[model samples]
Target: MVLTEYLSKEALEELVDSFSCAGAFELEILSPDGEVLARSPKVHSNKDSSINKEEDFIRFELPAEAEIFVGGEHVGTISLRGLWRTGQDSSSTSVGVKDSSNLALSAERQIAISPAAWVELMRDVVVRLCDLSKQVRSRVEELSAMDRMTNTFTEKKDLKEIYQLVAETMVKVTGTDACSIRVFNEERTELVIMAAYGLSAKYISKGPILLSESKIDREVVESRKCVYVADERTDERVLYKAQARREGLVSALCVPMIYRGQIEGVIHVYTRRPHQFDWFETSMIQGVASQAAWAIVNARLYHEALQAESIRRQLRLAGDVQRRMIPSQAPKIPGFEISTIYVPCFDLAGDFYDFIELPDGKIGICVADVVGKGVRASLLMSSTRSALRAHANYVRDLPALIKAVNFDLWRESEISDFVTLFYGVIDPTNKTLTYTNAGHEPALYIHEGKIRQLDVGGGVIGISEDAEFSQETITLSSNDVLIIFTDGLPEAINFEDEAFGRERVYAAALEAWGRGDSADGIGKHLLWEMRRFAGLQSRGDDLTLITIKLQ
Candidate 1:
């Protein structure tokens, strides 16, 4: 503490007054430069007399003076003087001598206390007051330091910045020579230094420290306690005693940084002198460590939440784009009704469908399912759809269109990814459907209460560039329905692990047809039946279905 902070002029005057009353004499408080800061009243009527000149008081000056101290540094002195009277009172009647041999003499003096005793007494009182002031100053300093440290922890947002601030604040508050913050790795096998203050880079980068190898760090972390080591040069618990000695560190304290009852790291403070850590200092450092831990945990959690939100936004965008890729409504075909349904288990789908109008009143209908899910599958599906559309504009043959699309997918997509597709063209003039099935579930044809499977085509797309395909034409009479879908329909599982198999699909189609359901009605009924079978189970894959019913 600074001397002037607690030893103001008014305080000095009060001290001098109290001392004068005790010593029964006037006293003056002088600075180290001999300037008077405070003075007590004198017994004699000499108030107007100046005490600035040391010459006037030299005759009555005390031989002893008491020194005022602040934190062991002397700032000023206190002194006392004797006041004397040298004549008789005017009220006394004096008799004169009769002759030259006779004479009358009178003298009066105010008794003063012994200078040595007064000096000792005043010195003790001043020393005690100074000591009390020092204690008060130290307490105020500590409280202010803690307030700053707590604010630092609360205001900082980044974990690394908080760590550095904590280390620096710890060093400042405790008057430590250096400080280091070591946080445990995710595996909890080692302690990694996150921040350091007032330490040499060479000493900080000494080497890796494994928790198993460092007993002191391990004890502090596992036991969630603070550990202190005095005389690091001789303490066996010191992990880097050689480095500590080189860094001129003789004392150390390690406090655990814990959050939610789990220790996350340790805050290590080092001092240059071999000093023991008191209870107050240890408790204060521990409190700082606790706040640091809370800040670190909050920072980590906030970062994770931000990352999760970013992923969610990306998924939503992908879902929107994938949905837009699929046709929003089916096209109009004379004497025919078309209905489509798509259900993706995730944000992006592997299943897609397109209805392209061809030349001469013919319409191209395609349903394809990629082998996988997510963004990759969606990309492959998009590329395949573009290829099919481009090829269908020129290529009239269903088998040739399938072959072109297969070649493009095989050349452009990853070798592991493949697509199963059913491409069919309906010739309204001839009332015939020509199609090719590329390793997909066969389209079911229901006519006159009889169900038939249209299973013709080749291997799945993207498996081989040289894959061959075939096309077949089937006559469609009135009341005939064609059902095309991905394997997700038949492979959908129930709570009992029972699949809604080919037989069930055929039965559902037959029942819907018998009930005189339209294309949309039949598709909706099939979905309802599938959901009923699945019961609380999630769809294992992307689901797509298209139904074409002849009017």
Candidate 2:
């Protein structure tokens, strides 16, 4: 039978060197397993060193410090003082031995020795190895459970699911029989319990804890680390602790969970026994808490991204609908030249322009800008245009037609939201232009190479429900042009932040008309001038330009 004491290689080397210098006897050192590890001589006396053979007569075993041994051509001394074991045992004479597998080492050796020392050494070695093995196994199992919990959270995409996962992991990893997770609300300066296990849900539902008041919980948050207490009964920090008493917590561990460098939450693990946790245990739990924090952040980001994409898609749809509402082609009025350009500041334009050739050979021209942008503005613009077109067939008088349009818009739209319009009818046979403006920008008229402006209109329509509108008339001659436009053109800014005001717009029109005798030539030149003036500057509003000439 053989007995052995397992020492780390470094400890063994020191002991072997000390014994060799003394030259007491030839020595054979074996592993925790019965296999000989090293020997004073280069080769074995009778047995092959490569294999553990039953035919070998000599077997070496670990001996206690100060112990002596001698044999035929083989002898040794061992020191157990520096050796590490699960625990200490003084009386035992038996030695512990490990097999080649390195899994288990046994001290129950059938060796010849004094009964008291033999029995004691065997008992101590066996018990220590067993306990150490169990501890290692438990640690591995705990780590495996932690991995499973983190994986479960990572598998989920929704933020709501993370609460349940974190709570379960905390309770399981701590072995505390109960656990809870909470978040801090900086705006309200309160802690909101998000999830809990092994506790009454009804009691915790009434949450929102003020950190400034909660001594234990707030301390954990402020410290930004794990807080632990071995015994709440004697701990000075745990005070006014009615909840801790009710929860039957004799020991507690509170760890702060951080996400993206922010203190997002805290996890509480409670135990009934007075427990002093080691650094390894606290660090392991903190690692798990960090995983929970990351999971929560990822879930929230995914949710927000989905919401933003949904909003963008809705805006795109609204833009498509608004575009379909506008006329695709301008009305063709014989003996009159008409051209228009409409540009929106946003994806969906509130500005709209249309030319309707009436059955009476008169052309109705409209350029309107709804007061806002997006779906609401587009809807209002669509409604206003529809109402005007329906009423245009009934009223030939420009003032009456505008008054009727205003009544319809004010009745249909909210008081705060309104439309600014410039509407008119062109009788080509008489070359007469009559227009009614609704608080819109002054219309420009370029005649005989001279620029004339008209701003004869009342307040904005649909603003004050009882707003009045008036009309003005002027005659256009052959080769004379009438320019109806939204404020987008005149109010456009340059890089210097200066507005391309009415003065500049009027000058551009005169210059444009003087450059070309035909209305088509003038329209092209005006647009070119505007584009150049507004270079690199975003269009501040919806721009609608309509030019009509009686030729």
Candidate 3:
């Protein structure tokens, strides 16, 4: 059988150089059938060419021969040629053959060694030396190569480059036909290839390797061990057997790359010919896989950190812009006092409030809560606030204006998006407040310590294109107070996760109003009461509130 597939030309050359004693020239590794599997191209030729022509060249001939075996099974033979100086005496000893004349110089032949004396001795030496250093010359060389690989791994910061380096090194060290690296996606549903070498891009793009479909990869991931497929074309465990056949990948060794006690990915080495990986090749790849796993983990962490920092910077800049959009101070209307508060748990908030000065001295007040958190919700809040302000003056009817705002929100939102809002106009001259609540936390109209929830309106905005809305108009009176807020106020959670329900909000509002406080005083007092009720626990959502009074 031809062992050409198993041989490494570089490793054989290195092995021959290590045993390059005096009178040794060429080394040939022949298969069981005497076909040359690998031969060192170091020093060789008959007396015909360069050796005789160049004075710097040494003379040599192929003569010594020995069998190479593993576990007492003869796999191949090593035939060595010996080096002889051109000026050596005729009686000087050779390695195995009788004619050093093939390498002889000046048309004279040097003596050869007795076949019986050194053939068996050189046979044991060549076989044992090759067996000991087939992969590497010594343990030190292995360690040196490993050290170099480790340094290379540590120096890498990009995941794709690291994977590519590891894949290329695997084929070089193991003498395999190809190598690929794949990592489990965040959901672990798919094995996505990060890098590959010695394989065509067409074969790699054959299909996604779904975990459920690839029994071999699933086994490697679940067991955290290497799996061998001697023949992928016929292996039932292989998900893409036909594709593997097209790729000419006959055998594969899948090694799990485990990081921090968890299997994160797999490293696969393939052979063009069917091959059972030996212990040395398996261990070498496993060692490289271990180092590569750590490098991959570090690269992922570094990339994620960069993304997080960029998001933080963006959110910080957005928060600054959002703060400018919100009314720094409530409009100061004649014969009326208004106050407002906005507290965001995160740098980016879903809640926003705006005051739009309308025609005929009617001031438009809006408090809206977009149905989400973070940057996305804040974006919706900005757009919704802008749309509502744009329609406030054009649509004098409260219900019609609410409908217009709802349509704008619906146009921009996905199915998961919507906004709860309270939009109202206060006419100081007419002493009337007209309002519409679009699925908002109802505004409380308080008179003489009684709380009336003004909650008449339609469903949430942005859910339906033709959502209907309703409105209410109330005649204002001296000492009458009105409060509007988002769900964050009443739904605030305590340390024990208990909500400060609507009743608590009413009680707090009444208690503050009973203090005979102005609108600003009452708003501040209500906020303090709610914070005290929450037991200083961090708020989970954006909190917003507004207080208005006719004094």
How accurate locally is residue 134 in candidate 1, as Cα lDDT from 0 to 100?
70
Instruction: Show where candidate 2 strays beyond 4 Å.
Output: 1-155, 173-176, 183-194, 197-200, 203-266, 272-291, 356-361, 386-416, 517-521
* Candidate number with the higher lDDT (1 or 3): 1
User: Candidates 1 and 3: which is better by TM-score?
Assistant: 3
Candidate 3's TM-score reads 0.72
Q: lDDT per residue, candidate 2, 264-335, as tens digits? A: 888877777777878767988898889988998888788889998998798888888777766776677677
- Estimate, for each residue in 1-551, the C-alpha lDDT of model 3 and write its tens digit: 23333346665555555444323344566778887665555544445353433332442344667776654777777776545345534553443354543444333433354332344454566556556554455445655777788898888888788889988887876678899999989998999999999999998898999999889999998888899999999999998889899999999999999888988889989999979888877888888899888888988899899999998999999999888998888888888899899998788899998899887788888899999898889889988988887887788988888888888888878889999999888888998888989899999999877889988888899999999998999888898999999998889889888998988888878888888889888888878877898987988888898999888
Best by TM-score: 3
Model 2 / residue 51 / CA error / Å:
30
Q: Estimate each model's TM-score.
A: 0.65, 0.68, 0.72
By lDDT, who's the top model here?
1
Candidate 1 stretches with Cα past 4 Å from truth are: 1-155, 182-194, 200-250, 261-266, 356-362, 386-420, 434-442, 452-473, 487-508, 529-542
Clash pairs (backbone) in predicted model 3: 23-82, 23-83, 24-83
Residue 145, candidate 3: how far off, in angstroms? 3.0
Clash count for candidate 3 is: 3
